[model samples]
Target: MLIAQITDLHVSFDPAFLDGRVAPLEAVLRAVAVLAALDPRPDAVLLTGDLAENGSAEEYAFIRHALGELDLPVFAVPGNHDSSPAMRTGLGSFMRASEASHACYVVDDFPLSLVGLDTSVAGKAHGALDPARLEWLEKVLGQRAGRPVFMFMHHPPFDTGIRTMDACGLLEGRERLAELIAWHGGVVGVVCGHVHRSIHTSVAGVPTVVAPSCAHQIALELRANAPLQYRLEPPAIALHRCEQGQMMVSHVRYIPDFPGPWRF
Candidate 1:
């Protein structure tokens, strides 16, 4: 099974977002076009978080329309910049109802089980997994025991060393989350998208990935007191391929019209 991951779109109705420094709408459209052109297209698309610049109705509507072009199953979770209520109402078709109040849910229709975690904190840039949400995850994993699961969320459970982003990273319940992944033992991988850059690590012996943004990315500043900054770098997405008895492999596909395919 092939699953495509697109994160931190930051799509806005305004073309001149971020003082016209980044064109998020155009960037996302290009990403979508790239996905559409894939030879063996991904079976599903995962929208990790920050689908909109602001959790506004108009922003959601615009993104919804843009993503509609894919015509493939899309799963999404809320990011810090997103409004849960707005997302549920606007992107209901892309999400399934969750037993918990948060936007957490699971998809079992494909070869790889998918668990989406809602790490967004209302009106805050940081993310957390409260008791209720964690309990929901535990229950889901228990019910799907022995299944190869791929968990996706907005905030990464580990620190990325990017000081500014780390300060606003998953601030709570990460320890417990790591424990859950270890205990489950069937979690194949954990994928996230808040950092806006492709990063990889391991959590509870499972490969964890942070996919790059489809729009601007956070500046790669690891300095001790560096201020938060974004760069209009090349946008990209992640593709995960899964097969029986093999570890899932992920690839980063940049969404730009760079010259390519020259024979070596």
Candidate 2:
């Protein structure tokens, strides 16, 4: 099975642009155009989070319009910037719900089982795995034992060492999240966003990925005390291909918003 991933669109409706600085909706449009042109296409599109800059109703409506042009299933979760009620309404009947009545959900029955976790702590940039979310995950995994699942979320459970971003990464009780991964041998990988930079690491023997945003990215800083460094990097997305024997391979791909040629 093949899956396409886009994250951190941070779109704003009405084309007003957020804070008179970033054009989040334009980025979203560029990513959509690229995805729609993929050759083999994909079974679904996974949006990790930060769908809007302020989680406004209009923003969600804009998201709905953009995604309606796709031919595959679209799934998403609430980021720090997403409002659950608005997301549900705008997304309509396609937003897959987990066993919980919320946005977190699991799509089983494929070689690529998708486990979407909600780590958005309302009104805060930081994230946490609350008790309710933990219990729901435990139950879902317990029942789906032996099924390889690819978990996705807005807040990465691990850190990238980019001080400011790490401060917004999954906070306390991450060890518990690790334990869940450790116990679930069927877990193939954990995919996340919100860092706006592409990176990867292993969590409990599973490959975890941090997908870059569809807009500007954070500068590649490896320091432990770095501040926010927004760079005009190529907007990118991730593609995960599930191979034989339950193995999953992923690649970080960037599609230029416009036609260009590079001579090497």
Candidate 3:
């Protein structure tokens, strides 16, 4: 099955339309336009949060508008910019009752098993996966034993080499996640967002990926000592193709003419 990963929209009610130089509301809208035009389309759209620039109901409404055109099931988790209750009230309508009603859920089906983990903690710039979430993850992993499961969250369960962003990934409780991945042979890969850059690595010998922002990207400079740099580089989204009993492969595509107009 095909799965699309859209991360870090960072949507905001930009009362002042500052073009691409400011928060990328238009960039996100452009991304969705491209997503809607995909040839075969995705079975599901898995968003790894930062759905809003601030945890505001209006911003969630903005996200709702952009995501509304897609003809697919959308699954999301809370990022630092998302409000748990608000996200529940907004996106919960598309989710199943068994989805736990907290903007976190799992889809174990024909082509793949997706585990949506919520790593957002209230009023914090960083993220964490605590005991309760970990235990829930363990239970889901247990239920899907022997099946190829693809896990997703807003924060990488481990570091991403960039010091500043690394500090923001799962904190002390990461060991539990690592141990679980180490033990579970069915986990084919881990997909996460929040760093706003694409990273491919292996954690616990399992392939893990960080989906870049749909709105903007963090400078790849591994240090803040350098000149401040954030760019309007082409916005990107990830596509994962999964076939049972085979490893999943991902393609990160940049939507061109984004935040602009182009005719076919």
- Against the true structure, what is each candidate's TM-score? 0.95, 0.91, 0.89
Candidates ranked by lDDT, best first? 1, 2, 3
Q: In model 2, which runs have C-alpha deviations exceeding 4 angstroms?
A: 14-21, 98-102, 258-264
Q: Is candidate 2 or candidate 3 better by TM-score?
A: 2
- 1 or 3: which has the higher TM-score? 1
Highest lDDT against the true fold, candidate = 1
- Higher lDDT: candidate 1 or 2? 1
lDDT of 1 by residue, 1-264 (tens): 898999999988775677666778778888999999997989999999999888999888877888889999999999999988998888877888896469999999897789999999898999999999999989998898888889999999999999989989999999999999888888888899999999999999888999999887888888899888877667899998888776668899998862222211
Clashes of each: 0, 1, 0
The digit string of per-residue lDDT tens for model 2 on 1-264 reads 788899998886545553344567777888888889987998888899889777877888888889879867888977888887778777775467554445678887576678888888878898888878888888888888887788889998887888898888889557888898788778877889998888888888788888998876787888777668776577798998876576568888895853222111
lDDT by residue (1-264, candidate 3, tens digit) is 888999988887775523436456777787898899898898988888888776778777777767877867888878888888787777654443444424457886546678878887888878877777778778888887887788888888777667777766677567888899877788877888988888898788887899888877777866654443466666799998877766678899887874422111
lDDT (C-alpha) at residue 44 in model 2: 82
lDDT score, candidate 2, position 225: 71
